[model samples]
Structures are given as C-alpha cells and as structure tokens.
Target: MLKKQRILTASALIAVSLMFGSCKSDYEKLKASNDVAKKYREAVKYYNKKDYNKALDLFDDLTQRYRGKAEAEDLFYYYAYTNYKLKDYTSAGYHFKNFAENYPSSTRAEECRYMAAYCSYLDSPNYQLDQTNSSKAIEQLQLFINLYPKSERVADASKLIQNLRNKLEEKSYADARLYYDIGDYLSAVMAFNNSLRDYPDTKYAEEMEFMMIKAQYLYARNSLYYKQEDRYNQAISYADQFTEKYPNSKYLREAASYRKISDQGIKQAKVLVAEASVDSKVAKKLAKKDTTTGQPQSVVGKQNERSPQNQ
Candidate 1:
C-alpha cells in the first residue's frame, strides 16, 4: 500500500511539472514577441526627444495593435499629441475627434474634445483671409461647451470663442470701412448693415452708426437731380437712426446739421419750382443771383406774397 501511494504521488508531481513548464514557455514566447511595453517606452523616449515623426510612427502602430489592450488609451492620446506637435493639424484634428467620440466616458474625454476644437482653431487663417476654420472652431467649441457644461476648460473655450468672433468681426468691419473709403455708398451701407446684424452689441456699433450716416449722406449728395428725392429720404432714415440711438454722441451735432441741410435743400427746391411755375421772368432773375451775398433783395417777391402760410 505504501509503494502504491509513492507511485501515485510521483505521477502527480510530474503532471504539475509539465503544467508549470508549459506556462513558462508561453510566458517566454509572449516576452519575445516584440514587447509592446518596451515599444511604448521607446516611443515616449522619442517623443521626449522631439523626434515627432518617429514617435508618431511608433505610437500609431501601438495604438492599432492594442486597440482594446491595457495601454490603449495612453497610446492613442500620445498618438494624437504627436500629430499636433508635428503641425499636421488635419490629422491631429481627426485623431483627436476620434479619441473623443470613442472614449466619451474616459477620464480624458473632455480634454480630447477641447483639443479637437483647438486643432481646428490652430489652423485658422489670418484675420483678413477666409475664415472657414475659424467658423468651424467656433461651432465645435460651442458644441464642446454644451457637452461638458461644468468642465474646468469652459473658461478657455469661452475665451477662444471670443477671439474667433473678434476675427470675424474685424474682417466685417474692415470690409465695411473699405466700402466707405472707396465711395461705394450703397455697398458701404449694405456692409455696415450686415455688420450690425452680426455684432449688434459690439463697441463698433457706435462707429458703425456714424459710418452708416456718412454713407447715406454721401449717397444723397451724389444723386442726380431726378434721383435726389429718394436718396435724400434714405439719408434722413440713417440720420434719424443715429440720432435716436446715440442721442449724446459727438457726431449727433453733425448728424443734425446734415438733417437740417437736407430739409432746407428740399424746401428751397420746392420754392424755386413754385416760383418758376408762377412767373418765369422773376424766376430767371433769382436764378442768376447768389443767395449768400448778404443781399436783402426780395428773391421770392410775389411768390412769397402769394404763399403767406409758407412765409
């Protein structure tokens, strides 16, 4: 009985040795199979050295190989950052967006979202150029704020939105002012009108109102005699708006003066027409005289006498 028990014990020991040896062999195989952890370390080393291209290649390969593996999140984040540091903004934006969408509940998701928006913001053109990226950055950042209302990054997003909006505003105002400078009164009016619609509460609103008045006034001044009536009315419309909106503005006095001149010119035009219709000879005499010569001669004689109410 003792001998049989020894044989059974030895057999059990051999079975355990084979199982342990197989486990050790498998561990060795995994260790030799291009150690992912070692690759991750090397990639980080390359990134620290600012060899972005090499770092990016390693990070990209690791991210794909370890899609759902232990270090996948860290690897993917560094992958996106590598692209960003390399100034490959489009690819950086794409990877960052992907990171945000795929890892919405991850610890770094909010940061990923913000970085995605910032990537586009970084690619925005100069203030004078097409602002497609600038517009997109605004929309995406607003969306990010909506998504993470209580994020610590909210302040940054708000500031970035303001900066981008200011760019658009600057472009609009510059174009509007250019129109004013070039004497395209109609186009100037349109541009200023659109600018106000876009930025009604801006500090430039006051300046814009002044510009609008000037444009309309000039438009009226340059109109043909036949077109003067309509143009004058348009000038009065803008002048009235300025006076109503900025009652205490320094430009108010000038605006009022313009208003008065337009009113007086229209009245004088009517009086001249009425006089010419009644007596062509006196009208011709008055037409040859200058009204500013400090002369008290009766230019409107019987015409004024005929319309006492108008006197």
Candidate 2:
C-alpha cells in the first residue's frame, strides 16, 4: 500500500511540473511571435498584474513597432509609466518629456510634463549631497507652471518647486556651516553672506545671521594687529546690522556680546598700534644718534692712553 501511494504522488508532481513548463513556454512563444496586437494585449495584462519587468520588456519591443500609429501615443504613455513603476526615474523622466513634446495636443500632455518634473524632483539627493537634480527639478516645475497657467496641477507644482528650493537652501546653509566648523572663519563669513544673498527668505536666516556675526568676530580676532582694527570694525558693523534687522531674534544677546568684544578688540588694537609706532620712532632716533656720533672709543683704550707706561 505504501509503494502504491508513493507512485501516485510521483505522478501528480510530474503533472504539475509539466503544466508549469507549458505555461512558461507559451509566454516565450508569444514573445517571439510577430503578432503586434497579441503582444500589446499581453503587455497590458502583465502591467495590470503588477509584473512590471515583463510589461517593460513587451513595451520596449512594441514601442518602435507602433511608431506613428494611433496606438503609438498610448504605447509611449504605457512605456513611460512602466519605467516609472520600475523606479527607473531617469528614463521615465526622459520618456515622459518626450511624450509631452510629441503629443502637445493630447489631454495627458500636461500631466506627463508635470510627471517629468516630479521625476527629477524624486531624483534629487539628500541636502548634504550634490543639488544639481534639485536645481533641474525647480527649473522643470517652473516651466510647467508657465506653460500651463490654468492647470490644476500648478499649485502642486509650485509646492514641489518650493520644496526643491528649500532643499537647495539647506545645502547652501550646510556648506557655509562646514566652513565655520573647520575654523575657516573668513571663508565661513563669506559663505554665510552668500547663503543669505541667495536665499533672503531662508528658514535658516536667523541662525545664519548669528553665525555670520560670530565668524566675523573670530576672523577679526585672529587677524594681525595692523589688520585687526579694520576687521574688528567690520565685525562690529555686521553685529550692528544683525541687531537692526532682527531686533527680537533669539541671537540678539549673543550678537550684542560679539559687537561689544569687537569694539574692545578694535580699541586694544589701536592702542597697541600707537604704542608700536612710538617705539619704532624712538628706536629710529637712537640709531640716527649712534650713526652721527661715529664709533665710540673703548674705556680700556682711554685708561691705557692715560697711564704713565703708555705715555
């Protein structure tokens, strides 16, 4: 009885294997066939089943075959979406843009254009990395808004652009802060200024302003005595500007402290410079007197000349 049951189980397993093999062979045969409609239908079925890889393959094959035909527009649309589904954003972005450009009159043109920009947005890296994609996303999104002023997607596009801009702002702020962290005060000051200039309304404005003041003060503190007065004065000026611009800012007290320190530094530097100037002048006067008097006679020579033995 056990041997008979084992034989039955073996037969069932073989039947299942054969059925699976036949199904796989059928798909392979369909792929090799030249039946355009059948291939397109199967691609759509695969797409609906969330089999994106298989759908992508079929769409890739059918794209050129349907070119310039009525089905081409829909085919390209599916192809772009397929790439998007596969997380191939770069290719998706290109195909989406191509579809919009090729079919400007299509109702889906605006959507595709927006998707192209969104793809670029999605491709944007972290704020700590390169921001080229963020810039590109902003440009694309802005263009989309300009081209379709009445588009319902305009609001969303605008928001996306703002988000990208914020990312860029963060990158700028981080880069400037890096200079500060590394004790490059002068570079930090310049970088902070640039960040503010580029993004006047940045959320980091308050922190950046405060850091700029501190950086300038440190830069002045590290300067040579001759340059200290001017650099410290500059720091004081920056502090004053910060105070005036953000009177109620949380950094107000710290900024005021920096200003006070800078003022003290300027005064000390001026005094030292004056003392140095006086000392230099006195030294010059003594050197001149020595030069005018010629070489002095040694005391031993004078004593020897006065002694009777020398006489």
Candidate 3:
C-alpha cells in the first residue's frame, strides 16, 4: 500500500512539473516569435502583473517598431514607467522627459514632466557626495513649475526643489566648515560668506555668522603685526554685525567675547605698530651716526695725516 501511494505521489509531481514547464515554454516561444501584436499584448499583461523586467524587455523591442503608430504613445508611457519601477532612475528620467516633450498635448505630459524631475531628485547623491545631480534636479523641478504654473504637481515640485536646495546648502556649509577645520581662517571666512550669500535663509545662517566672526578673529590674530590692526578691526566689525543680527542667539556670548578680544587685539596691534615705528626711526638715526663718525677714515686721509712732514 505504501509503495502504491508513493508511485501515485510521484505521478502527480511529474504532472505538475510538466505543466509548469509547458507554461514556461509557451512564454519562451512567444518571446522568440515575430508576432508584434501578441508581443505588445503580452507586454502589457506582464506590466499589469508587475513583472517589470519582462515588460521592459518587450517594450524595448517594440519601441522603434511602434513609432508613429497610435499604440506608441501608451507603449512609450509604459516603457518609461517600467524603467522607473526597475529603479533605473537615470534612464527613467530621460525617457520621462522625452515622453513629456513628445506628447505635450497628452494629459499625462504634466505628470511625466514632474516625474522626470522627481527622478532626478531621487538620483541625487548624499550631501557629502557631489551635488551636480541635486543642482540638476532643482533646475528640472523649477522648469516644471514654470511650464505648468497651475499644475497640482507644482506644489510638490516646489517642495522637491527646496529639498535639493537644502542639500546643496548643506554641502556648502560643510565645505566652509572644512576650511575652518583645516585652519585656513581666511578661506573659511570667505567660504562662510559665500554660503550666506548663496543661501540667505539657510538654517545654518546663525551658526555660519558666528563662525565667520571666530574665523575672522583667528585670521586677524594670525596676520602679520603690520597688518593685524586693520584685520582685527575687520574681525570686530564682523562680531558687531553678528551680535546685532542675532542678539538672543546662544552664540551671542561667545561672539561678544570674540569682539572683546578683537578690540584688545586691535589695541595691542596699534601699540606694536607704534613701537615698531619708533624703533625704525631710532635705528635709522643710529645708522646715520655710524656712517658719519664710527666708520674708518679714508686711505688718503690716513696717509696725509701720518706723513713725515708733520713729524
């Protein structure tokens, strides 16, 4: 009885395997066939089933063949989205932009345009990496908004643009902080100023301003004695501006302290300058006196004075 039951189970398993193999063979035959209509239909069926890889393969094959045909529009749309579903964002972005350009009058054009920009946004790297994609995403999103001012997607595009811009701002802030960390105070001050100029409303504004004051102070402190007074004055000016702009800031106390130190530095720098000037004048006087009296007499004068006619 056990042997008989085992034989029955083996027969059932073989039947199921053959059925599955036949289904797979049918798909393989369809893939190799020259039936364009059947291929297109199967591609759509696969797409609906969320088999994006198979759908993309068929769509790619049908793309040029369907060109100028009425089916091309839907075919291209599906093709673009299939790439997107497969997470090929760069290709998706290109195809989506092409779709928007090719079917400007289509109702899907606006959505495709926004999707193109959003894909670029999705492609943007982390804040520490290069921001070319982030910048490109912002531009694309902005263009979408400009092209479709009343689009419901405009709000979403605007938000995406802002997010990209924030990432760029973060990159700029980190670069400036790098200059500071490396003790390149002058470069740090310039970089921090550029960060502020580029992003006037950056969340890092307060911290950047405070850092500018500190950077400037350190730069002034490290300058040559002759240049210190003016540089320190500049630092004091930065500190004053920071304090005036953010009086209630947590960095206010530190900024004020920097200002005080800069003021003292300016005073000391002036004293050093004055002492240097006095020392320079004294050295010049002593040099003139040495030239006039301390130098050896000329050979002719010594010879004349020691002549035997005088003896």
Candidate 4:
C-alpha cells in the first residue's frame, strides 16, 4: 500500500510539472504578442506625452521587427513624425521622402510630402549662409506642388517658398546696398550683379539697378579728376539702363539730374587738373631757385611763376 501511495505521489508530481511547463509556453507566446502591442501603444502614448526620445526608440524597434506586419504603415508615419518633432531635420527629410515615395497611393502620402518639404525647409540655414539648403528646400516645395496640386497645403507651401526666395533676395540687396553706402563701389557692383543673376524676377531688381547706377555715379565722383572720365561714362551707361528698365521709377528724375551734373563735373575737373599740373611745375621750379641762394629771396616768391607773356 505504501508503494502505491508513493507511485501516486510521483504521478501527481509529473502531471503537475507538465501542466506548469505547458502554461509557461502559452504565457510566453501571449507575452510576446502583448509586448509588441504594448510597445506600439507606448510609442503613441509617449508621443502624446511629448516624450519624443522614448517614442522614437519604440518606433525604431517596431519598424525593424514588424516592418511587414499589419501596422507597418502606421509605424512608418509615426517614425517620420517623431524625427520631425525632434528637429533631426536630415533624418526627418529622408524618412518623410521615403514614406511619400513608397506609399504614393496611401492616404498619408500628401502629409508625407508636405512634411518632407517642411523638413528640407527647416534644414535651410539663414540667408547669410551658403543657401544650398535653401535652394534645395525651394525645389522640394516646388515639386510637392507639382505632385499634389489639389492638396490643401499647396497654398502655404507656395507662400513659404516665396518667403524663402524673398529672404535670399533681401540678403543680396542688403549686402550690395551696404557696399554702396560705404563707397565700396567694386564690391557693390559685384554684389548687385550676383543679385540680378540669382533672382532676376525679384521685386528688388529695380532697386538693385538703381543702386548700381548710384554706386557707379559715386565711384566717378570720388575718382581723381584726371581718371574720372571712364567712371563717369560707366555711370551714365548704368543711369540709362535704369531709365530704360524702369521708366516710371521714382529715381528717374534723380538719375537724369545726376547724369547732367556728372557730365559737367567731368569737364570742370579736367580743366582744374590741367591748371593744377601747370601750377605744380611752376612751384617746383621756384622752390629749386629759392634753395640755391643762401640769402632770403622774398621778391621771387611774390612773383607769379607763369611767364607774363602767357598770362
């Protein structure tokens, strides 16, 4: 009887061990499924909580583990969004572009396009920088417009591109104008040239042309009398360009008046330079004569150096 009792106990122990093992296997399977669900839910939860880092980490895991799963599309969008929120613009741009390219027919494609363009825009630096990123952003936004013409974001994207272009235009104009104001005519001329070349359609083109004219005029005005003829000629050429381009410009009368003054000044300056050259020669000769004599020579100093016959 004791043997039977021991056998029954052993049997009971075996059955219980098998039952526990089976339960452990089931539990592990359920835990894994729930873990994936939990992580996904937690990603959303953290995103809502503005805990972007945690959200991003979970998103990264979801994208890697469940890329072909049912929730892949949802995960992809959130991944891009999280990067955008973190201001990792380069990553955000790539992810958003990927989403848009792969899921062109998806409902989120439009958003992805917009976000991608926005990320590129965010990557753009200030106007003082090289502007390579700014140009990229403009191109992306323009492509977004072409791809999604009916999108609600179209108007805003167009306006943003215009604003960026305006910033570049303004920076160029300001740099050129600063040179003009400081009398750095050569730099001003080059800056204006670049401004026109880069943004010929800009509203500031008129002002740029006007400034070029003004800078050329000042360059002529500041030149030495004998060397001013070329500068004045260049100044008049620019003035004529401004007049032809912007006939109704507020500066037309001013430009016309400046041209007259510049022409007259060139003639007067030439005459003054010639007379001064003659006077300088005469003075040098008188100084040599004065140096040769030990006695104080007051009589020759008072006499006009020019020959009386020429006078």
Candidate 5:
C-alpha cells in the first residue's frame, strides 16, 4: 500500500511539472512569434487566469507595436493593470498616469487616474521610514481630488490622506517623545510645541499639550537661575492652555500638579533675580565711588585697611 501511495504522489508531481512546462513552452513560442495579434490573445488569456507575470511580459512586448492604433486603448489599459497586478507599483503608477493622460476621453481614464494616485498611496512606507513617499502620496491624492471633484473615489482618497497625515503626526510625536526620554528637556519642550503648532487638530493634541507642559517644567527645573523664570512662565502658560481646552482631560490632575511646580519654580527664580540685581547695584555703586575719587578700588581697599586707627 505504501508503494502504491508513493507511485501516485510521483505521478501527481510529474503531471504538475508537465503542465507548468507546457505553459512555459507556449509562452516562449508566442514571445518569439512576430504576430502581435496572437500575443495579445494569449496575454488576455494569461491575465484572465491571474497569471500576471506572463501577462506583463507579453503586454510589455506589445505596447510599442500597438501604439496609436485603435486597439491601443484596451491594450494599454490592461498593460497598466498587468504592472499593477504584478505589484510593481512605481511602474504601475507611471503607466496608469500615462494611460489616463493619453486617453483622456476613455471611460476608463478616470479610473486609471485614481489608481495611479492610489498606487502612490500604497507605496508610502510606514512611519519609521523616510516621509518623502507619504508626502508625495498626499500631493498625488490631493491633485486627483482637484482634478476629479465629482469622482466617487474622492471620499476614499480623502480618508487615505487623513490616514497618511496621522502617520506623519505620529512620527512627529515620537521624535518629541524621544527627546523627552533621553532627558533633553528643553528640546522636548520645543519639539512638542512645534508638533502642536504643525498638527493642531491631531488626535494626539491633548497628549502633546500635556507632554509639552511637562517638558517645560523639566526644562525650567534644570535651567540656570537666570533662565528659569521665563521657562517656568512658559510652562505655566502651556498648562493654562491645556486646562482651558481639556478641563475634563484624564491627565488634568497630573498637568495641574506640573503647573504648581512650575509656579513654585517661577517664584524661586524671581527671588534669585532680585538678589542678583541688588548685588549688582551695590557693586556698581562702590565702583562709581572709587572712579569719582580717582582711585583704583584695590588701592582704596588697602588704604581703608591701613587707616583703621590701628597705628
């Protein structure tokens, strides 16, 4: 029985290999044939069967031969789709865009145009990669909307734009958070503030605002006494903004505590500034007396030291 089972499996494998080999043999023969019509026929068959690689090879061969002919419309349309189905999105995008531009009045033109831009959307990488493709996708999608305001795809395009925008926002948030995690408090404060400015309507707005104030508080706490007063004041201002916008925020209590600490920082900084100013004024006054008396301060100090009725 085991010997019989092995024979059956071997037979199945041989049949499968023969089928694939015959398909390859037919494709190679058609490729070498000078008949564009036969090639087109076989390309359609391959496309219908979802054999996109074979379809792509044949379509690529036929594009030049069929150009400017009546058959070019359907041929070019399928050619672009062949590339798309092959997952060569960059080439697909270009070819699809070209088809729409070349066949402006075709019923398929609008669909191809939308697909071209959608391909770019599909090509956009995740947030961890460079954002060049994401930005490009946004541009392409927006242009599609402007060109085809009545297109049924416009709503889906808008949703895709927002989704891509959210990804960019996440990258920005992560960059700011990284600074905070690395103990770069001042940079974190600036980055979080910039993020909020760039994406005011972001879903991360509340969290960003909360982090910004927290970053500012840390920045103020670490700053030199002379710089702390202004930084602490900024932290307080951010906290106020957060409270006003999201009074019911889950982070409200923590944010309030950060604000309180910032207030105390400002008070301490103010005291230091006052003491510094008083010391500066006293030093200047003594210097002015020495200058008016036409004596060096060191000489005056020595004279005072000697004259002390000690003799």
Candidate 6:
C-alpha cells in the first residue's frame, strides 16, 4: 500500500510539471511568433480569463508593434486597462489618457478619459502623503467633465473631484494646525488664516476659526513690545469675526476667552509701548548731550527730574 501511494504521488508531480512545461513552451512560441494577429488573440484570451499579468505582458509588446494599424486603438485601450487591472495605475492612467487624446474620434474616447481619471484617483495616496496624484486626478476629472458634458460619467467625475478637494482641504488644514502645535504662533496665525481663506466652506471652519484666534493671541503675547499692540488688536479682530460667523459654535466660549485675553493684552501692550517710546527718546537725548567727561550739568538736572537711571 505504501509503495502504491508513493507511485501515485510521483506520477502526480510529473503530470503537474509537464503541464507547466507545456504552458511555458506555448508562451515561448507566442513570444517568438511573427504573427501579430495570433498574439493579439492570445492576449485577449488571457485578459478574458482574468490573467491580467500575462495579458499585460502580451499587450505591452503588441502596442508597439501594432501602431497605426486598424486594431491599434482597441489594443491600446485594452493594454491600458490590463495594466489597471494589474494594479499599475500610474501606467494605466498615462496610456488611457494617451489613447483618449490620440483617438478623440473613437467611440471609447469618453470612457477612456474617464478611466484615466479614475486610475489617477485610485493611485492617490493618503492625505498625509504628497498629494500630487490627487491634484492630478482632480485636473484630469475636471478636464473630462469639460470635454464630455453629455457623457454619463460627468456626474461621477464631479463627485470624484469634490472628494479629492475635501482631501486637499483636510491636508491643508492639518498642515496649518501643525504650526500651532509646534509653538510657531505667528506662522500658525498666518497659516490658519490662509487655510480658512482657501477653504471657506471646509468642515473644520469652526475649529479652524477658534484655533486661529488662539494662535493670534499667542503670537501677540510673544511679540516684541512695539509689535504686540498691533498683533493683539488683530487677534481681537479675528475673534470678533469668528463670533459673528459662528455664534452657536461649540468653540464659541473658547473664542470669547481669546477675545478677552486679546483685549487685556492690547491694553498692556499699549502701556508698554508708551513707556518704551518715552525711555528710548530720553536715552537718545542723554546720549547726544552727555558728551562731557562725567555728565553735563543740564543732562544731570534732567536725569534728576526724571531718574538717574535714564541718564
């Protein structure tokens, strides 16, 4: 019984090896064949059988050989989709876009253009990564909509554009918010303001406005004495605008606190600026007139009237 079982297993292995060898031999013959038509037929067979890697290999070679022929357009379209099915979206998008542009009169032009944009959308990475592909997808999708207003894919393209737009908005918002987290208050203030300006309808509007107010207040509080008055006033302005825009926002209370802080900061900054200005003028006058060895009598009298420290 053990000898018979060993024989059966050995025979099965031999049969499997022969089957693979036969398939490999056939593939070799197809590769070396001068018959483009035969290769095209085999590629389509493999594609229909869901063997996209094999189909892609065959189609990639055929596309270069079959250029300018009647079957070229169909072959090119299939070639792009074969790459798409194999998860090579970058190549797929490029070829599909090329097909649409080169064969504008083809019945599949609109579909190819849509597929090109869809491939770009598929290739778009997460928002935290560089969004170059997502931006390109938006451009491609918009172009498709412009070119094919009557095509059924236009609605879907618009929706896809909106989705990519939201991703971009999120990326921009996160980047701006990061400045605040890192204690770069001035840059955070500008970044948040620019983000809001760019995406007025972003879902983060309330949170962004509140954070912007906080950033502005912190920026003012840390600024030089001369600059703090203007900066704190700017924070107060931002808080006022935020409250007017979102009175019932969840951040309203926090926004009001920033407003109060900004108001107090503004008064304190103004007083500091005033004192610094007076001290600067006094120091300048003392420096210019105190050319005497020890101290000029007039300057010393002025210092006594004010304070000897000012001298």
Which candidate leads in TM-score? 2
List the global CA lDDT of all models.
Answer: 0.77, 0.84, 0.83, 0.76, 0.81, 0.81
lDDT of 6 by residue, 1-311 (tens): 99999999999999999999999999989988889999999999999999998888899889889999999998998999898888899999999999999999999999999999999999988988899999999999999988889998888999999999999999999898788877777777788889889998988878888887777766665556556668878878998998998888987777777777667666765665567577987445433432112211221123331221222
lDDT of 6: 0.81
Q: Give the TM-scores of the predictions, in the order they appear.
A: 0.69, 0.85, 0.81, 0.65, 0.76, 0.84
* Residue pairs clashing, model 1: none
Task: Report model 5's TM-score to 2 decimal places.
Answer: 0.76
**Model 1, residue 175: C-alpha shift (Å):** 1.6
CA lDDT for candidate 5: 0.81
Better of 1 and 3 by lDDT: 3
- TM-score of structure candidate 6: 0.84
Off by over 4 Å in 2: 274-311
Ranking by lDDT: 2, 3, 5, 6, 1, 4
State model 3's lDDT: 0.83
Candidate 1 accuracy as lDDT: 0.77
lDDT of 3 by residue, 1-311 (tens): 99999999999999999999999898888888789899999999999999999999889999988999998999999999999999999999999999999999999999999999999999999999999999999989999999999999888888898888889999999999888887788888899999999999999999999888878877766556567678778878998998888989998877777777677777766766677687987445323321111111211223432221221
Show pairs that collide, candidate 3. Answer: none
For candidate 2, write residues 1-311 as lDDT tens digits.
99999999999999999999999999889889899999999999999999999999999999989999999999999999999999999999999999999999999999999999999999999999999999999999999999999999999999999898889999999999888887788888899999999999998988998888777766766556667778878878888988999999988877877777677777776776677687987445333321111122221224432211221
lDDT digits (tens) for residues 188-239 of candidate 1: 8899999999998777999888777767655654543334456667767888
> Whole-model lDDT, candidate 4?
0.76
Candidate 4 runs further than 4 Å off:
1-37, 67-70, 125-130, 197-203, 221-227, 243-254, 265-311
For candidate 1, give the lDDT of residue 269. Answer: 49
